[model samples]
Target chain A: MAARLARAPGISLQHSIRHAAILLVAGRYRDTDRSALCRLHDQLPQPRATAWWGAAPLTDVHDPVTIAEGDDPVPQLRRLDRDLLRGARASEPDWLPDEPPNAWRGKGDHGQGGKGMMGGVPYGRPMAMMGEEMRDGLMLDAMTVTIGPFLRTLPPGLSLELTLQGDVIQQARVATPAYSASGIASEPLLRAARILELLGLPDLARRARISAARGDDDEGLVAAARRRGALLALPADLADVRARLDAALRRGAAPDPGEECLVDRLAGMEWQSALLRVASFDPATLSRIAPAAEPEEGEEEKAA
Target chain B: MTAADLAFYVLSAVAVVSGWRVFRTDSMVRASFLLMLSFIAVAAIMLMLAAPYIGMATVFMMAVEMMVMALFMVMFMMNPAGLNPMSMVHQNRLSIGAAATAFVGLTVAVLFTDLPHEKVARQAPVIRDLGHELLGPSMLVFESAGVTLLAAMVASVVLSARSGRFGPSDEGSRPPGLEPGGEPAGRVPESEQEDE
Candidate 1:
């Protein structure tokens, strides 16, 4: 469904909320995802509206624009965008409260809140502390961050806790496993298109999607992608990812599930490369490789 | 004051203020970019001073350097977005002392030193002269340095490749063969050939 939206004319899907003017909520979300969804809604800039496509509107949303299942959402989305811009439709209010997550507690002259240079939490969050480097022996600041349940790059509902040093991931743990794959999501052409998009070939990705929708073999699409150096854009070091991309382009069967843990595979890779590696796998294979870690106390309340 | 003099004063203020903000900004990424702005302002002043080549070169070089620096800052710094607002500097007192000393020394030199007052002729081909100066006698040195830098870039790429000449770098890697059920493409170690 998301892939179809990406292909729709005049409907560009944005990775960041800041870039988007309308929040399109499609498909069912978990009950726990409510706060996160609300946060996302609030992040969208002013003159924004929410269009629920085949999905129930959030309880907080006022007079939501709902699209029925089996109907094309493109027209409605375009109308909503147009209406909002024209000021004919009312802009949606923020679902979440406008307040800082932590209290400001600075005591110093510059509001540093700590003695000397690095003593206390300036706001509420503690400064990133040093950790033993993964690649080198030197100790460097390592940041542990929760990435997504809805990040465009990763599969839906797949959230990860990544400890990073420099751009490289020192460690990774799956906070939540990805939702089960729908038949359309597992299509080879769509999978290949996703990889092409990641490789910075959006035109080729669009062609691949069009071909998939038309039930075309897409031999020309594959050839065009190759001519454009789609394969070359990928790092040679990530030969596995390259192979998966090739296989997907050729409409080959999915790769046999490996015994290696997903977290182990991801560690030591830079963030971009790691995302590419993760995107290379089918959802079933990914779920097999990355079992969810036991949820920590109060972790449910935290949204990235 | 003349327009040129007024422009110079404004640019000087921008350079100094932005340079100071480089330290004051909580975000390391923002700091690197503020430093770039300061460099650009100084470059603009250099242009006003009639050194086009130096000014343009400063802008180009600082743009690239600051971009890389910003990337590094995002990669290494904790809370690179400054969501928590933390100090980026360490050994603050020592840094302040050194900076103050350098400022004083530079200010004294600018104020007291005997400086050339001769203005460059308005029609003088300054950039052309600089080009000749760089590419004439020191051409070989510059060319050699360029080649060496290129070589270093290639060497780094080769060294960082996960797959080595011998075989796959890890258990998961499966390098494709030239033909179906054939030996893998690229150079294979003699030991592997013997085992096969």
Candidate 2:
């Protein structure tokens, strides 16, 4: 097949057909009569087939490696993560659109018939001329009026009409709906939402606030909510929390003290670091350190 | 067998055995893996016989093709990594046996046939000559193979991929809405919402 492919090959359909037949026959025969024949039928390129496996009768090659021990010696997989990150950073071109048309195919010299040999210019400088035309077409007499840069900063729910000067920001007009702000409260619920999100307890925080504002003040519900909130406020670093709890206990301070405005101190503290320090001395450790356990039978065996 | 003969025989035995197993293995994936081992052993034999490129390409191309098959297996199979027995055996056991017998008979006949021997001393290195041959007419085959691979990729993507540069609906699906940054919409519509 290689000899045939090497000799008379200019995309040989017959050769491919024969190759396909060989592949079809390469598989083992389960119901060797019917399915094999059907495979033989499909293997032929033409419906009224001629090409077979030729004279090369397929035989089973016994692979000893399958039964052999481990994997064949090869290099371990190379890390391409850093290289990919580097490629991503280096691909940022200034001429390209800020948010390109699509991430897969970003805008800039996609198709111009000619390749990159001419430094992004097509042969005969047609693209340069077209760019000039686009610039000229952007500047018209009707668009020459002054509309301030602040016009683009439309408030939420307000609409805007933009006028461009050759892909540059030229003028914009803002139009807001009448009485859109009438029903809304002065304190933006959204600010609380942002705060809660930053606090990393958006759902529970919002629910608690909403329930309290609605005046459904069941004392049990409020107490439970506050308790949960305080617990949630406790830093995720177990060691730190444990250390703080132990220190408070040691100093005879209240274990469940009201500690508002402590978010700044706790923020960004590493979880494992705090956990390790706190876990270093639990109740058992403290007892061990102080020799507080009463003497018991089989204590010597237990210690051993 | 003597150690030298044993080494030669064992190498030849494994090479031939694995080569045979390449045909016998039930799973295509396993078959391909076996074929790689067989080829590696054959390449060892080639090192003995003094031909390198043929052995290397045999290993290289087979490895590449097997890797591609592995990828396709991952993408298409429902249990992508599950090891299930896939028997490719078909119905022609007797005919297959007959055909195998005939081919083996022919090969044995070739082996038995007498031929005149050339008594020239081995001066030219076999690997060098093999490399030259590969770079000769075989180079065109090499390049065309590359082109064929590219064409296959383009054709496969054209046939199988649902979406292209234009839109998804071109292949009979709803056109996916474009997000400015390709992220999902931050706000969920009331209709799509479910109870937490």
Winning candidate number (TM-score): 1
Model 1, stretches more than 4 Å misplaced?
A105-116, A182-186, A292-304, B4-51, B58-119, B127-196
lDDT of 1 by residue, A147-180 (tens): 8777766766678899998789999998777666
Fnat, model by model in order, equals 0.13, 0.00
Residue pairs in collision within model 1? A107-A113
Considering only chain A, what is the TM-score of each predicted structure? 0.89, 0.17
Best model number under DockQ: 1
Each model's TM-score? 0.73, 0.29
- Looking at model 2, give its docking quality level: incorrect
lDDT of 1 at B49: 90
lDDT of 2 at A292: 30
B99: Cα error in model 1, Å: 8.6
lDDT of 2 by residue, B64-148 (tens): 8777876564333322221222334456798699889999999998999985475433464666766687789699887898999
> What tens digits encode model 2's per-residue C-alpha lDDT throughout A1-304?
1111112222222212333211212111222222323433343432121111221222222211110112211111011212223442121112222442223222234443223322332322212111111222211222222221111111112222334333332333332211122232311222222223333554543443343334343234324434546335555544344334334222222233233222122223343232222222223332232233232111000000
Query: Please, what are the lDDT tens digits per residue for candidate 1 over residues B150-185?
Result: 999989767555556665443343447889978776
